[model samples]
Target: MNKPPRKKNPTFGIAVFIVVAVLLVIATLFYNAIKEKREFDSQNPDTQSISSDAASTAAAKPASGAAQ
Candidate 1:
Protein backbone atom coordinates (compact mmCIF):
# COMPACT_ATOMS: atom_id res chain seq x y z
CA MET A 1 0.00 0.00 0.00
CA ASN A 2 1.20 3.56 -0.89
CA LYS A 3 0.98 6.41 1.67
CA PRO A 4 -0.17 9.97 0.76
CA PRO A 5 2.00 13.04 1.57
CA ARG A 6 0.73 15.71 3.99
CA LYS A 7 0.37 19.28 2.82
CA LYS A 8 1.44 22.31 4.87
CA ASN A 9 -0.51 25.58 5.01
CA PRO A 10 1.78 28.43 3.93
CA THR A 11 -0.98 31.03 4.08
CA PHE A 12 -1.29 30.78 7.86
CA GLY A 13 2.38 31.44 8.36
CA ILE A 14 2.31 34.38 5.97
CA ALA A 15 -0.70 35.90 7.70
CA VAL A 16 0.94 35.64 11.09
CA PHE A 17 4.15 37.23 9.82
CA ILE A 18 2.20 40.08 8.23
CA VAL A 19 0.26 40.72 11.44
CA VAL A 20 3.44 40.81 13.51
CA ALA A 21 5.15 43.12 11.03
CA VAL A 22 2.20 45.54 11.07
CA LEU A 23 2.09 45.54 14.87
CA LEU A 24 5.82 46.29 15.00
CA VAL A 25 5.41 49.18 12.59
CA ILE A 26 2.54 50.63 14.62
CA ALA A 27 4.48 50.35 17.86
CA THR A 28 7.51 52.07 16.36
CA LEU A 29 5.35 54.92 15.06
CA PHE A 30 3.70 55.36 18.46
CA TYR A 31 7.05 55.41 20.20
CA ASN A 32 8.41 58.05 17.84
CA ALA A 33 5.30 60.20 18.32
CA ILE A 34 5.61 60.04 22.09
CA LYS A 35 9.30 60.92 21.90
CA GLU A 36 8.57 63.90 19.68
CA LYS A 37 5.86 65.16 22.01
CA ARG A 38 8.19 64.93 25.00
CA GLU A 39 10.93 66.80 23.15
CA PHE A 40 8.46 69.49 22.07
CA ASP A 41 7.12 69.94 25.58
CA SER A 42 10.61 70.15 26.99
CA GLN A 43 11.73 72.75 24.43
CA ASN A 44 8.59 74.86 24.88
CA PRO A 45 8.02 74.79 28.58
CA ASP A 46 5.39 77.07 30.20
CA THR A 47 2.52 75.69 28.10
CA GLN A 48 0.57 75.23 31.32
CA SER A 49 1.39 78.75 32.51
CA ILE A 50 -0.05 80.35 29.34
CA SER A 51 -3.57 79.23 30.21
CA SER A 52 -3.27 80.57 33.75
CA ASP A 53 -1.86 83.88 32.47
CA ALA A 54 -4.72 84.21 30.03
CA ALA A 55 -7.25 83.60 32.77
CA SER A 56 -5.62 86.15 35.05
CA THR A 57 -5.49 88.75 32.29
CA ALA A 58 -9.14 88.18 31.50
CA ALA A 59 -10.09 88.61 35.14
CA ALA A 60 -7.97 91.75 35.52
CA LYS A 61 -9.31 93.35 32.31
CA PRO A 62 -12.91 93.12 33.47
CA ALA A 63 -12.13 94.67 36.84
CA SER A 64 -10.00 97.46 35.34
CA GLY A 65 -12.63 98.29 32.71
CA ALA A 66 -15.39 98.38 35.31
CA ALA A 67 -13.36 100.78 37.42
CA GLN A 68 -12.94 103.28 34.54
Candidate 2:
Protein backbone atom coordinates (compact mmCIF):
# COMPACT_ATOMS: atom_id res chain seq x y z
CA MET A 1 0.00 0.00 0.00
CA ASN A 2 1.31 3.47 -0.95
CA LYS A 3 1.39 6.08 1.83
CA PRO A 4 -0.13 9.51 1.21
CA PRO A 5 2.11 12.58 1.55
CA ARG A 6 1.23 14.95 4.40
CA LYS A 7 0.23 18.49 3.56
CA LYS A 8 2.42 21.22 5.08
CA ASN A 9 0.88 24.39 6.57
CA PRO A 10 2.93 27.61 6.74
CA THR A 11 3.54 29.12 10.16
CA PHE A 12 2.53 32.79 10.74
CA GLY A 13 4.41 33.06 14.05
CA ILE A 14 7.41 34.76 12.49
CA ALA A 15 5.24 37.27 10.72
CA VAL A 16 3.35 37.98 13.91
CA PHE A 17 6.62 38.40 15.83
CA ILE A 18 7.99 40.81 13.25
CA VAL A 19 4.79 42.85 13.29
CA VAL A 20 4.80 43.00 17.07
CA ALA A 21 8.44 44.02 17.11
CA VAL A 22 7.78 46.81 14.62
CA LEU A 23 4.80 48.02 16.63
CA LEU A 24 6.91 48.02 19.81
CA VAL A 25 9.62 50.05 18.11
CA ILE A 26 7.08 52.54 16.84
CA ALA A 27 5.46 52.82 20.25
CA THR A 28 8.86 53.37 21.88
CA LEU A 29 9.67 56.15 19.44
CA PHE A 30 6.29 57.79 20.02
CA TYR A 31 6.75 57.61 23.79
CA ASN A 32 10.23 59.09 23.53
CA ALA A 33 8.97 61.93 21.36
CA ILE A 34 6.24 62.79 23.84
CA LYS A 35 8.70 62.61 26.73
CA GLU A 36 11.18 64.85 24.94
CA LYS A 37 8.48 67.35 24.05
CA ARG A 38 7.34 67.50 27.66
CA GLU A 39 10.89 68.03 28.86
CA PHE A 40 11.50 70.75 26.28
CA ASP A 41 8.26 72.50 27.18
CA SER A 42 9.15 72.42 30.84
CA GLN A 43 12.63 73.76 30.21
CA ASN A 44 11.44 76.54 27.91
CA PRO A 45 8.32 77.92 29.54
CA ASP A 46 8.84 81.30 27.89
CA THR A 47 8.56 79.93 24.34
CA GLN A 48 4.91 80.99 24.05
CA SER A 49 5.68 84.52 25.19
CA ILE A 50 8.59 84.87 22.81
CA SER A 51 6.49 83.63 19.90
CA SER A 52 3.63 85.97 20.79
CA ASP A 53 6.00 88.92 21.07
CA ALA A 54 7.48 88.15 17.66
CA ALA A 55 3.99 87.85 16.19
CA SER A 56 2.98 91.18 17.67
CA THR A 57 6.12 92.85 16.34
CA ALA A 58 5.53 91.43 12.87
CA ALA A 59 1.91 92.57 12.91
CA ALA A 60 2.94 96.10 13.89
CA LYS A 61 5.10 96.44 10.75
CA PRO A 62 3.32 97.34 7.51
CA ALA A 63 4.05 94.97 4.62
CA SER A 64 3.28 97.67 2.01
CA GLY A 65 5.61 100.23 3.70
CA ALA A 66 8.74 98.67 2.16
CA ALA A 67 7.21 98.85 -1.37
CA GLN A 68 6.11 102.46 -0.92
Q: lDDT value for candidate 2?
A: 0.89
Candidate 1 lDDT by residue in tens digits, 1-68:
88798798999999999999999999999999999999999998867777898998887776754666
lDDT by residue for model 2 over 27-50, one digit each (tens)? 999999999999999999877766
Per-model C-alpha RMSD: 6.0, 5.1
Worst 10 residues of 1 by lDDT: 59-68
Clash pairs, candidate 1, are none
lDDT of 1: 0.90
Tell me the TM-score of model 1.
Answer: 0.61
Model 1's number of clashes is 0
